[model samples]
Target: MSNNIKNIVYRTLSKAWATLLEINYDYRFKDGTWKRISRESYDRGHGTGILLYNVDKGTIILTKQFRMPIYHTNKDEAMSIEVCAGAIDDNDLPESTIIREVEEEVGYLVKDVKKVMETYMSPGALTEKMYLYVAPYSEEMKVNEGGGLASEHEEIEVMEIPFSKALEMMVSGEILDAKTVILLQYAQINDLIKNRE
Candidate 1:
């Protein structure tokens, strides 16, 4: 509630790529005590991710790209396999953003996308809520050679792998991205793959 917070102050630390804020606020405890706290939150805005599956073929589309953060952390391997995703810019809806992302990142124009779930990716420090989706696709959906937007410095490699193999990759630690894993597991749990046959 608004009454629980007081003396809130926000300082911008960076605004180049995304906005980062250092926030200080006073909170009222359950015992009626006030405590001041300081925290930093990175606000890059909310985004969406979609797992493209071909039930008939038992395959899913994934994208491979170089992730700078992962490169810095791992030192050797930097390319990450993940579902097609992007941030919702301006006032665009999450579903619209994901549909555009799917086209741009994987070259697929999909209809009948199902909203699976929405979750906060990193609640501890970052403010990002990701909308997850799944869509059934066929070869006719391919409209262009999707490699992402070069203007945004995106060099994505599109990959179509068997659903079973993707699950194995998750167990083998090859698919490390949380959203990708969650969507993959969702497909399995919902019997989306099995029903395709």
Candidate 2:
């Protein structure tokens, strides 16, 4: 607790699919005055997302799936094109979670993935720190059809698109997922693919 903030309190609002809590706190102003405030925080735990690329093929693996939250905002276009990702779940490390997710979500059993960065997808209300990564992939690395798991009701469409096209999609507003966009930009800025023309 910082000196600027004090008298913290938490109350559970919901404990379904994810946990939601209402937090009340008192803040001290620079002028020596204190004020109380209330805010709702949604704790869904942390997750990971990875950008699987193939320099030899000049392409990248992405996933297209229906997002209910997106549907809530824009019903006309609820399908989102994004990097393969999932909740960290019981995995002890973010790296392990992403590795397993890559195989289960995209059918690629990638062994080496370089962590690029981590970000809070939505810090204002959601407590989800997304571990972003980039990994090299090839046909030999694929083990299955990688459309996500049926148990989770995930109907993910695997897309192996040219790197340039992925960039174009980012510009065309087709790839609106923040983690996907950030990873794509990271690849571009870092020249992760050399054969991309």
Candidate 3:
């Protein structure tokens, strides 16, 4: 409800996997002039992402899954490597959502997680605020062979790679997911895991 904005109108364009809305609004510029603008926003809601690292083992857990949008753009590299993440439910907080996703997606029952940052995956067109976290993981913490949920039609490949290798992948453009790259870089900056042998 800023004075700079007025005469807002919203229309739903589609509602399936995510809600698409058409918006029209009047904006008052710094010159004291007003202009009417129309735009569309895709609302898939907020989500959380966590990067699990093993300090002693010098390794990290990542997931590989097929992204339809990425598939549309890069057919050869449709399988995207990313941190464990999931959409936040209306009833759930960011921390809880990530914890549950870690367990469901990576098969790790991690209770203590340190939130690193919150980011918008794509601010321009999609309204998805990503809560990023880092957590310590060990072999004992793993509860199952997580490949994602069948009900959600998620087919994920769990990866346990060395920290240095993860960094190399990031630099080589193998880790294309922005959230995953950010969390990996956070781990590197914070020395969460051993960078070299």
Best-fitting candidate, scored by TM-score: 3
TM-score of predicted model 2? 0.96
lDDT of 1 at 94: 91
lDDT tens digits by residue: candidate 1, 95-159: 88999999999999987789999999999888999999999988999999899999999999999
Q: lDDT of model 3 at residue 168?
A: 97
Q: Write down the RMSD of candidate 1 (Cα, Å).
A: 1.7
Writing each residue's lDDT as its tens digit, candidate 2 over 62-154 gives 999999988998986799999999898854699999999999999999999999998998899999899898999999998999999999999
Which residue pairs show collisions in model 2?
none
Off by over 4 Å in 1: 195-197
Ranking of candidates on lDDT, top first? 1, 3, 2
| Worst lDDT 10-window in candidate 2 | 188-197
lDDT of 3 by residue, 6-94 (tens): 99999999999899999999999999999999999999999999999998889999999999988999987799999999999988999
Per-model TM-score versus the true fold: 0.95, 0.96, 0.97
How many times do residue backbones clash in model 1?
0
Error of 2 at 115 (Å): 0.6
As for TM-score, the candidate ahead, 1 or 2, is: 2
